[model samples]
Target: MLSLAAESWMLYGIACVVLICRYVSRWLQLGSVSRYQIEDYIMISVFGFYTTLLVTMNIVVHYPTNLIQPKDVPNLTPELVAARIYGSKIVVIVEQTMIMTIWGCKLSLLYFYHKLTFGLVQEWAVKIVAAYTCITWLLMEVLYFLVWCRPFTEYWAVPTDNIQCTAATHHLLTNFIFNVSSDLFIMCIPLPLLIRSKLPFAKKLMLCLLFSLGIFVILCAVLNKYNSFKHYNNAMWTYWYIRETSTAVYTANVPMCWALVRRIFNLRAFNSPDRNGIAKLPETPNIDDVPATIGGGEFRKQTTTPQHIMSAE
Candidate 1:
């Protein structure tokens, strides 16, 4: 039987491929394998966490396993029933862990966005947004699980038995709402600053297109919330959840793939034009004279003064 676990693993492979391309292209751009940026480390670590989430989901419950029809419950072996209960418990934990996986991807994107911005004012603004988003994500993840199933073990038990447990629709809706909104906000945060950049019309259009790719991530987040309607049905939930979560990772990695695109095309896409209609060569900017703009978006000429001859007359 096809299972969400199988599908998620497939997406994991795809994510790894994209990440490999991102890293290789980055190194190629720098003309060296030794140099690494802070975002590179964070992305690698996020991929590690993503891998763990995929692996854990499959191992804990064999969640993708086909179930015997309910009519056959009376004929089931005691061992099989016990196994199902154990798997159910594991599912609870897996759901909780999934939050961490999603948040890791979001945080990685936020850091990447922060790295791309310049100016002390802009940098702090992005940092503050990042910090507030982090706090909101943490709180959402915590409350979604705990408040929804106080004495957390009850989530698994209540699914099959009539034990007291919180209603899930509201919680699911709340979580999905937050997820979609956050995804949209993060993707939109850079638009104003980018729109105001001094880049040429074509460059600005291309950059916007590059960042606008996150609109796919926003779609994934919306669909993710839509699928929560099936929260009580594992088969339906797994079917949609796999796509939703995988898409989260997929969208997160797509923008990073720009490095590979640039490398493959041998395009100095970010370089600005010089006065002679040639690409400006890179130069070290003096702190005092440098504009608050980042290099790829603007090419301010280095200030030079001609020497004046002085003679005693």
Candidate 2:
């Protein structure tokens, strides 16, 4: 029978593969209105790079040993000590990727705000909030690495009983605090603007529904952080693995899916060009389609494009 941990690990991997295909399909569709933005490209690269490192580390560390080592045999040098060292490095990389992916999602939300919100103040506010979020993430990661880099073995092993090492609690809490803050920031940034937008009732409802999807990601982060703090056993290895992989895979995949689904459903808020400055009114009417007079008075019949018609009161 499969254990819960093993099942979660398997499901996590499958989710990653599913999400990767989803992203690639969007790139290939030629019909998805969603062009991969800079944030999207960064997310894909980070996900791919970190996943490659993780798989490589898994093979290097776990492949050489058989299911059992003979009890009579003495210890021998493992396939490569490099795997442990590199695995440690990859753990750090994966963490960075998670942090980057968070910021990327936040920026994508801000970009959505930029595209959807019309006011200059709202645009500048999103930009400033994005900048602050990015800077703080970078600083925290840099500080984390610096703390981890001292003697390095401090990360995975206890070098000396006498040497006091930085508590993992400190790092974990710092990370958790910032991640939750960033998530709340992403969730809150566009609310006021969205509430005040000129979109019709239906479109406004759709926009809220779409934005709420990010809440799923925030929940993932919270659960993953809780597991990270609580896990301390061999069985919990699976917890760590699932948490890392799921947080990476699901968060990355969901936004791409949202964009595609919105495009397909023809959500007027997402599709209407007038909402994004891709439309304008024409000053001149075609002579072939002239005015219609009513009650002996002359009046020009209103001519509106499909986009304009959709942006109704």
Candidate 3:
């Protein structure tokens, strides 16, 4: 029972920290270019939504974190039942927020791809499809939560009242269907480009893994859907939802978060970061550029000193 309360938040906390680190690293590297991008702002909004989810979960009253036995129904007082009913309303909001947060993060990655594949993908149709996918998620899934029921209150009352409600099963299946399908669409976009790069086989494989990390988010969506059937308890289900939310946000941020990890470890191999609009000129160093004549193998760059300046020195 305690695991229900603790585990999701633990994961959410880590995800939140990692998301922050990703942006912090970006801002440190690119200033406003990093801070103000549509993708970066969307991630911040998603993190805000995730934070609201955590707060609402703690503040609202939920059911007995265990299975609701028939005997326990009698023990449920009017106040407890009312609070639980109110919690149901909050859960509906949380569910909507979850869809938004998860898809918002996903859209951010898609937008990243949109920018990434701009000139790289020459065909207009491919870019149109990617844009349409983001718009479809925004219009179809997000609004589906708002209008799924004829009267929205009816949707929340099912937990506490004997109200006839639409089948959530169908909506969930549709939700996960789009979830995984869009995931496939986004993951597939840059593959041909990456595969054709002059980069060696190992580097290409690493890029593939980075882009395809969303598979874990898809896995979480699958597991959460599976758990929905096995654990019908409200509190337990809430934990699963939180896990899904955290994984969504975490996976979305990780493509950028490696920069933070590299910095913290003093790693330089992948030291590349956005250096603003300036193009990095290659260091065309030659043998004459090095002062190898210095004693004890100590070397300094050879500076061209004027003849008069050298004589004065």
Candidate 4:
């Protein structure tokens, strides 16, 4: 548990650093916080829920919980039972915040894709994926709160024999299905556009790699569920929970940090303007209105950043 707490805080710290870099990149690119897009604001809210998740997970670790082996149930005194109940209550908050944090990341990515595909044929795909993501989230919530455990109190009921209430097997399964499927849908949104763009093969691969960071998040989700099922009695799932959320936060924010990377390193390849004083896509002349950066889409008249180009790829 000590190690788990340490790992959680460490991952949270890294996530905070990346988030700061994301916003700084946005500010430098857009020239002001007022010009920040919807995805930027969504990430801020996601981080708020992520912080809550970290605090609640630590509280769960500090207190004993009903999620223990059957052997431990025989020795449960009133004080231990009460502590377990308290921890179980905290588990409810933890689950909610975890869902919020993960789904918030999904929503943030969807918004970014919406802007990325705007004024293009791929915009319709974004809309469809956005609807699917939202619907799955709602279904997962309904299954968790209403279907899985009856009357909502079984989740914290001490001395209960229901594994569904104690171990949350049903919740985990449904969440796995919805979460992974939605992430795949969201990931597919930008790939086709990147492929269709006439950018050089190397740049296309780089952009695809950036958008494909969600693959790590998806892998973490799978490993999280696998460990939870394999070591249900040992609380091994807690570590993966931290890892999955941190990876999601990282994947969602990293693509936006390119501006900061370019600024700090003085990289001229992507940000250099052409002789006509406009951002140039080497061979793609048909889509010059499309923004080049993954996250920033403030293509207003006042903006003169040469990073804006034909396509995100």
Best by TM-score: 4
lDDT of 4 by residue, 1-313 (tens): 4588899999999999999998998777667889888888899999999999988887787787677778877899999999999989998998899999999999988887776765666678989989988999999999888898886898998967878788899999999999999999988988876676545566668878888999999999999999989987665777888899999999999988876887798765442354556653343322222235432222311233444433432
- Candidate 4 error regions (>4 Å): 68-74, 269-313
Candidate maximizing lDDT: 4
Q: Give the TM-score of candidate 1.
A: 0.74
- In candidate 4, position 45 carries an lDDT of 93
Task: Report lDDT per candidate.
Answer: 0.57, 0.48, 0.58, 0.79
Error of 4 at 124 (Å): 1.0
Which ranges of candidate 1 are over 4 A from the true structure?
Answer: 1-6, 29-35, 56-81, 158-167, 230-234, 272-313
176-242 per-residue lDDT for model 1 (tens digits): 7667667777777666655765656676676677667667766765666666564444545555555
Ranking by TM-score: 4, 1, 3, 2
lDDT of 4 at 181: 95
| Per-prediction CA RMSD (Å) | 7.9, 10.5, 11.9, 5.1
Query: What is the model-wide C-alpha lDDT for candidate 1?
Result: 0.57
